[model samples]
Target: MKALVFDKSGLDNLRVREVPTPLLGPHDVLVKVKLAGVNPIDYAVVQLIPVQPMPHIPGAEVYGEVEDVGEHVKGVKKGDRVVVYNRLFDGSCDICLSGREMVCRNGGIMSVVTNGGFAEYMAVPEKNLVKVDLPPELSASLPVAALTSYHALKEAEVKPLDYVVVFGASGNTGAFAIQLAKKMGARVIAVSSKPWVAEFSDHVVGYDQVQDKVREITMGRMADVVINSVGNAVWESSLKVLGVGGRLVFFGGLTGSQVNLDLSTVYGKHQKIIGTTGGTRKELLELTELCKDCRVRVWRILPLEQGREALEWVAKGKDGRIFLKP
Candidate 1:
């Protein structure tokens, strides 16, 4: 099997190499990889994180077909199309029992701490796989981005008629956040530095306002809910745009995480700050259904062999997801 292996050195440490197929357990499913979603963490694992052993495959979200399944796996069978919930959690953990497996204490992320999806074959726990009716036209890129965005909005508890502002709306997670927030009946205010991003929305480029033009549109009111994925670059601005008692959902810190914040605003405004990661299996399933119904649009696909290229493009901060077809 051909897999992408990362060493702590740098890009030179990344290479396509032959590796043995993963061994499966009774409660696991062997998936023939079709597409692997390239995330920032993929590159981070290669450059920043300590090498897992000597070689590690870095990928989290994967969409593919089930080649075989363990006897205990009832949700899917051979030839079934599926999406995986990247969080690997112990079923007995307190968080898992309460259906909050994303925060499971004992579970570790597959690619980060274990073998991930960037390979010809990978074995995953049956509970982590969500069976979906894969549409021929819908590629892997859509599900991964949509699922993450869906989960982020769900965590924020976005409501109808709410003023929802999404920072970095052109990026993978932000794009989905914009559409999902709009679908939920919230008046979406998508913030992005990209000039053409607003074309995706029915509301034109100056239809509402750009990030710099926000003050004119909001008239000093601020948004009711702000979905921020850009880390330090927009953290202060995002915080400044929140109305009193509003909520802010933090998903990723793409630029840099460290930031200085004024504590008085949080206490004085009674605002809420929520942190979220990946989505649940059920949420991924719902996201797939939405895509199948043509409610969501997936924009791009790239082969797994070109994983490095995909990672580079994402690092450039492009809009939409880049799927690696394994």
Candidate 2:
């Protein structure tokens, strides 16, 4: 099998090379990779994270066909179309039992801890596979991008007629945040310069205009929830748009991680600042149903061999989603 591999922690080290096919565990399923979604975290893993083993394959979002099923696998059979859950968890863990499997104490993420779907094939536990009705290209992105936004919105507890502002509204997670907020009955204020953002959001404005526009639209009440997936670049602005008692939800730091916060502002406004990571499997399942007809812009689809280039695009903050075809 040929896979995109990095023997060290650097984007420059990534390359496509022949490797042994994965051997399945008794409860594992071998998936023939069809499309692997490229995300910013893939770049982060290459540059920062210390992944085990000398050589590592870094792709967390997978859309593939079941090539083979292990002896104990029963839910899916050969030729079944599936999307990888991407988050590896043990069902017996305290967090898993409490329905927060995304943070399972005994678990680690795919691609980071285990070799992921950046190859001709990948072997994952049967529990990590979800059968999908959508096309492989589209479903490939849901596990990470859409699920993250969905989880953030849920955390914010958005309500009908609530004003919801999404920073980086044109990006993958941001676009999904706009659509999902609308679906949840909240009026969406998308903060981006892109015209496509208007298709999903009730209102669209550039970052420079977010504060003034949000104030006008909400009639001075401000936003009930602010989704700031873009990180510190817009952190202060995101906080500025939120009304008293509002929730500020965040999951990514694409621009920069560090930020200065005035503690008095949060307490005075009764605001809640929450941080989230990968969503639970339960939420992913719900997202599959809610967003089955979802449409995402595919910026490019390159062959698996061009994995390095795809990572570069993600790191550079390109528009639309990028996929790797294997």
Best by lDDT: 2
User: Which residue runs of candidate 2 sit more than 4 Å off their true CA positions?
Assistant: none
Considering only N, C-alpha and C atoms within 3 Å, which residue pairs clash in candidate 2?
none
RMSD of 2: 1.0
- Residues 1-326, candidate 2, lDDT per residue (tens digit)? 99999998887888899999999999999999999889888888888888865699989999999999889899999999988998888899888999888889999999889888899999999999888889766699789989999999998898999999999988879989999999999999999988888888899988887789999999999999999988899999989999999999998887998999999999999999999888988888887799987779889999977888888888777778999997
- Tell me the tens digit of each residue's lDDT in model 1 across 130-196: 7777663344544456767788888889999887888887777777777778778887777766665
Give per-candidate clash totals. Answer: 1, 0
What CA RMSD would you report for each candidate? 2.7, 1.0
- Candidate 1 segments whose C-alpha is farther than 4 A from its true place: 51-53, 136-139, 142-144, 199-212, 293-300
The estimated TM-scores of all candidates read 0.90, 0.98
CA RMSD (A), model 1? 2.7
C-alpha lDDT of residue 154 in model 2: 92
Give the whole-model CA lDDT for all candidates, comma-separated.
0.75, 0.89
